[model samples]
Target chain A: MGIQNTLEGSNTEIPEIGALDVDKIKQDFPILQRKVYGKPLVFLDNAASTQKPLQVIETIQQYYTAENANIHRGVYYLSELATQKYEHSREIVRRFLNARSLKEIVFTYGTTDGINLVAHAFGRKFIKEGDEIIISEMEHHSNIVPWQILCEETGARLRVIPMNDNGELDLDQFRNLINSRTKLVAVVYVSNSLGTVNPIKEIIQSAHEHDIPVLVDGAQAVSHYRIDVQELGCDFFVFSGHKIFGPTGVGVLYAREEILETMNPFRGGGDMIKSVTFERTIYNDLPYRFEAGTPNIAGVIGLGTALEYVENIGYEWIGAHETEVLQYGMNVLSEIKQIRFIGTAQKKAGVISFVVDGVHPHDIGTFLDREGVAIRTGHHCTQPVMDHFNVPATSRASIAMYNKKEDFDALVRGLHKIIKVFS
Target chain B: MDELRELYQEIILDHNKNPKNFGELPDANHSSEGYNPLCGDRIKVFLKVKDGLVEDIKFTGSGCAISRASASVMTTLVKGKTVQEAEELFKRFHDLVTQSPQAEVNLEELDKLAVFAGVREFPSRIKCASLAWHTLIAALKEKQEPISTE
Candidate 1:
């Protein structure tokens, strides 16, 4: 029997909020019911990518089976239906982020693509030589590299906000870094490596004091909590679909409509232009101007279904369940005397990164895989975070809404077995 | 599975705990660095060759038990061998770690190095076992660029 069965049979109360039945919720993910190496699969690698539910899976299948057609500029019946579905997905994304209008939501390949677009389009138009772009030290490489490239191209300098030992960003130092020359503030809403949910509202308010625009990387935050772009007053926000139980190759870039209108196009192609002559080309409206070519139609529909599913479950229950699991995991793993927790910020999400005294993370990952427990062991695309911690890599276990206390139990068991072998 | 036991044998654990030639050779003439970027395992192999024979050899780095122990075992096997013999041994060792798990290995030829034959069962660790050997080869060729098993 699985850990869920064992826990349910015991006298312990499962501490669930509202209708957050984790056992019933786990039934939605078909992959979780399988066995790996004759043991039940315990997936803890949610930070890398979340597993798709049957709802999202069936949405994509239905799109391909009946509603497959190129969106926009089609005269046939199926084309109109496909266009409606694609636009409906955009509306869903706009509502999910609580943006001002559908014009503020632009579809892209993923978060990296969206960041690259802003770095190229906005940076080329407004930023000049001697300008500065501020980022944090704990940012993923995706958020750092594009700005570095933009700095290289525009002769702008990149400044970083340092982090404390507890993995929280030094907001005072961040305020010190902003000045007239600071063009924009690009920061992550929640760090994928450290699991630190940054104070983005305060950061945005601070930047606005200097009349500087801010771009929040919400790739790690959208799945953990609800986001209200209008309320945050950030100029731009970006997140990926795969990180939120949706399909890959689809993401949302929520830019203020006025700001998006001013930025130049990153890629120039068909459907993004109204009329193209040999001399000049007039661009399309707010969103289509940024989305150059044929977007991922089916993937967008899958994302809509995924967002609708999250809406039905509600963020309050999801957040409460995830917090409980995170606390339980920290308490269980703290029992290991040799384990050192890497990120101990009080305002953390479901991610827990730790390193054993004498064990390399790769070996720990291999041993855990044998026990049918999956965890990510590396820098997690945040090399600077690892460098700051003075470790090459770490073993990370991030929780999703579907995760339970039993998953942490299996992970702790696997870790104990690893310590035995290494000892 | 039993393959995990084969991969982490007693010999590997001993060598990992007390590695042989586990420091730098400041006076060495030839040296090269090898890095596995995936796991951040960096190794620098130093060699002192005189009259076509390996006069002295050492390595400096940090990695998993499999990699550190493989480097330790490699230094012991190729200490006094000739340059050509070392290259030939590298070929045999490479084949030993990369071949199918069911394939027959001549244990007498491999001698102490036979402990690494089980690495074939774990495909991801083949690069770990071969990192030191590749760095040694780069040292022999006097290549300036660091070898990376990406």
Candidate 2:
């Protein structure tokens, strides 16, 4: 509850607090400096994947140039150094989420991979026939499809928590949907498509009342806000590195130490097993049990640096700057008479989803692309949310810490150009 | 920028706004659906074919201006043509859109369909311009399975 208090600060200027210097932040990302379509690149597609900062890019380069060796099981000098750096990245992730122990942090490919791991290992072990799993209408396909596959495999029923017109989940309906047969509840911390920030603490607390575990898809949440897994009390939290300014093919899955211990090993291979016999195999300890293969060593190092970069900037400035930009974007976009916002949730992050009355989202996307303004257009991997809104697609502009007010101006100008073209 | 202007020509915009042969045909012998999964653009092409000649052609769906306009223009051009002629026209239109941006197009053969020649410059929108034509081919061949611009 106090976490919500931290996020609800007024938009008053605090010059002494060192307000986020977006121009300075933009310098860290080289891609932002490049031109697209002969115009300055205005990147608003942060929700899809964020651009890497110099720190993270250099971290990957340094890892490859210096400590390029296979981790774990090697006794040589470079191998020891590589293993130490890799595990140090794990500790970085552990601190990033404030998990109880290093054992609680497991590295995977990305958010999708982490969710699939839980669905397979935890679902096979705990979920049974006649059991029920609850998810929300706002979950991305990654969160929905894996559970659906799990339900099909285990003969469990998948129940959905409906949302209102504003894209906010109906907690009463959620409470009604859960019963004795309910095995687990999986939901998104921040909706990728809607930008709705669900009250995760209350959700986790409610699930705990029924003694049911909750898994939070934090793919869209981690980069924008500070995440303390211990404070949230969710059993499992998942996020992707690419969404948080890190390199792709690396992510973190934070599970409680006891819960991780209970679930079966996700994948069996060299690093995940202590000893393998012809007929019997003993799984390795908590974290390694989930990591089965030779991991993305350089990507992991890059992710560590990415997390450090965010920490150095501090969440307070990030949140405040994003809030100001989100307000500016909304205000500017609302000027267009044809604009109809899809996600009008009272509490939102840095996303604006809207559709023009007479124009298709794809057309809007192409027109904006010509102006060097990049925005996502489609169901955004949350097809169910699109179906709920009865729209084929919506144009989405997601903001980040590096986004400036001028970006919103360019976006509004782009929208005006699109409207004129369609008219 | 010139290519962008060519892609969204006034004719394409007019066709998108007032699609000539828009809606379902009640007495259609052949019908097929075209879908672009990337952007969820769906168009159902309904044709009234008799003696291998298309008596009437119509389409109903929702999509970008390029897709809707392409379907509208295609229905107008293919309405009194034989199945063979329609198939030939489909090949020409496909070539016109997919050809390299710098390639010289024989616009005399394409006629009104030449408006879509600008799609060559914006490679991603080429599928949007061709979805309806592909669906028309599927209908002409009596293929029951819906075609997709994957």
Candidate 3:
């Protein structure tokens, strides 16, 4: 109660606490060396979008500066060079996902685009009126709305697998939800609102048993963990590039080769067609048929460089570091009397969603911003999760490989100041 | 700190802590809901209109301090005033919060709602400050659908 921290009374200086080598990792990102409101930036909004390192940025710049040309069907040297770089990036993505072949990797705008493509191309071909598409209560709006549209368009029933109050999915209910009529099972790899690392591998296995294909929304999961599509046995895996320190406007969709052959093209354009007559047209091939029009060539190259950046710093090290930081943040923030976390699953990632007593999350977000601690404050595109918790929104601080213990300390300090002002 | 203090003034914080007329107006003629989909902040305004005057006004919802406080102060400021007077106040309040920095907003003109003048500094929160006022407009007209500050 003594020396209550108010808006005007507190200074925003964060004392530099020494860390061993995450500091070395942070040096790679140029935006990390930044000040907001004259305070050192404590960026905890990694769940929304990660800041790109210099490697990704420089690669993007190098592409535009030196090799800026259209790919596929150009006979010039520059066109061939750009095409090879673009193909090489696809090879990188194939290796990154451990897909069987480059034919499995198709670049899209982002995860949402990838999901929409599946909804159109796959759903139109396979799904019927009485068929069901199973999703979870913890899905982001991006995952839910597309299926809802597909259901409305095709008369397909959308079944939701319920979750407990702890934000963990009920696999029993999921097993019950699947029947002879269930066409697809799509679930998130990690809950963006609740940090719950879902058992998507098990979900995939259960769906595959019924001869159903599953799509894993790895948008939030790809940045933190190493994903192997072969090991996961998921039929389709989709993720965004910007979430994993890569360029925006680029993403990867990995499907089995045979499945790709069955699905029709999402778009009809120049690159996707082999032979076209006014009377008859034939689709080009596997990955190319899915990737229509001029793609984000520079973005693909930058994404390749970004994945290499993650590879150079192994996932084993990143995962361990994230666990340590998540635990440390939970410990420090739990000390406050008013703090109540929304997600406390048995297994969680670096994201922490909480509500403070008598204070709204938007207010918490504004106060924290003044202290230069960036955190996501909302339903996080998962309104159903917000409704399940019966709270309007949550103040979420999600961490990344570059985040350190001091970031949480800064956040704790900011929250204390906000609580004092409100109290 | 100076900008923060200007934005979170003592009046705004106090009203947020203890909002005025915050409940369901049991005998209300006009009602409307406001939603900010960006942050999921929601507010519902209820008014008992009588003889071209706002006899009573109340609100119930969850949002940031700026929004709740704005709604609270708005109820207090517009109660017992004529519908036309309240509409005029709404115009002044909107101008006070959304006016460009280069253009001067006369404080004495806004009276109680002048604290929201700080809101113009933050473009994102301008919608937050103006949500209740927009909802109040909808309530005045008895709009059936919810008003969204997208």
The most accurate candidate by lDDT is: 3
Q: Flag regions of model 1 displaced more than 4 Å.
A: A1-18, B143-150
RMSD of each: 6.7, 5.9, 8.9
In model 3, which regions exceed 4 Å deviation?
A1-20, B143-150
- DockQ ranking from best to worst? 3, 2, 1
Model 3 docking category: medium
Evaluate model 2: give its lDDT.
0.89
Candidate maximizing DockQ: 3
Model 3, A140-220: lDDT tens digits are: 998999999999999999999999999999999999999999999999999998999999889999999999999999999
CAPRI verdict on model 1?
A: medium
In angstroms, give how far residue A113 of model 1 lies from its true place.
Answer: 0.8
Clashing residue pairs, candidate 2? none
Please list all clashing residue pairs in model 3, or write none if there are none: none
Output DockQ, candidate 3: 0.77
What is the C-alpha lDDT profile of model 1 across B1-150, one tens digit per residue? 688889889899888889999997866777889998887788989888888898888999988889999999999888999999999989999889888899998989999889998789889889889999999999988933333234
* RMSD value for candidate 3: 8.9
What's candidate 1's DockQ score?
Answer: 0.62
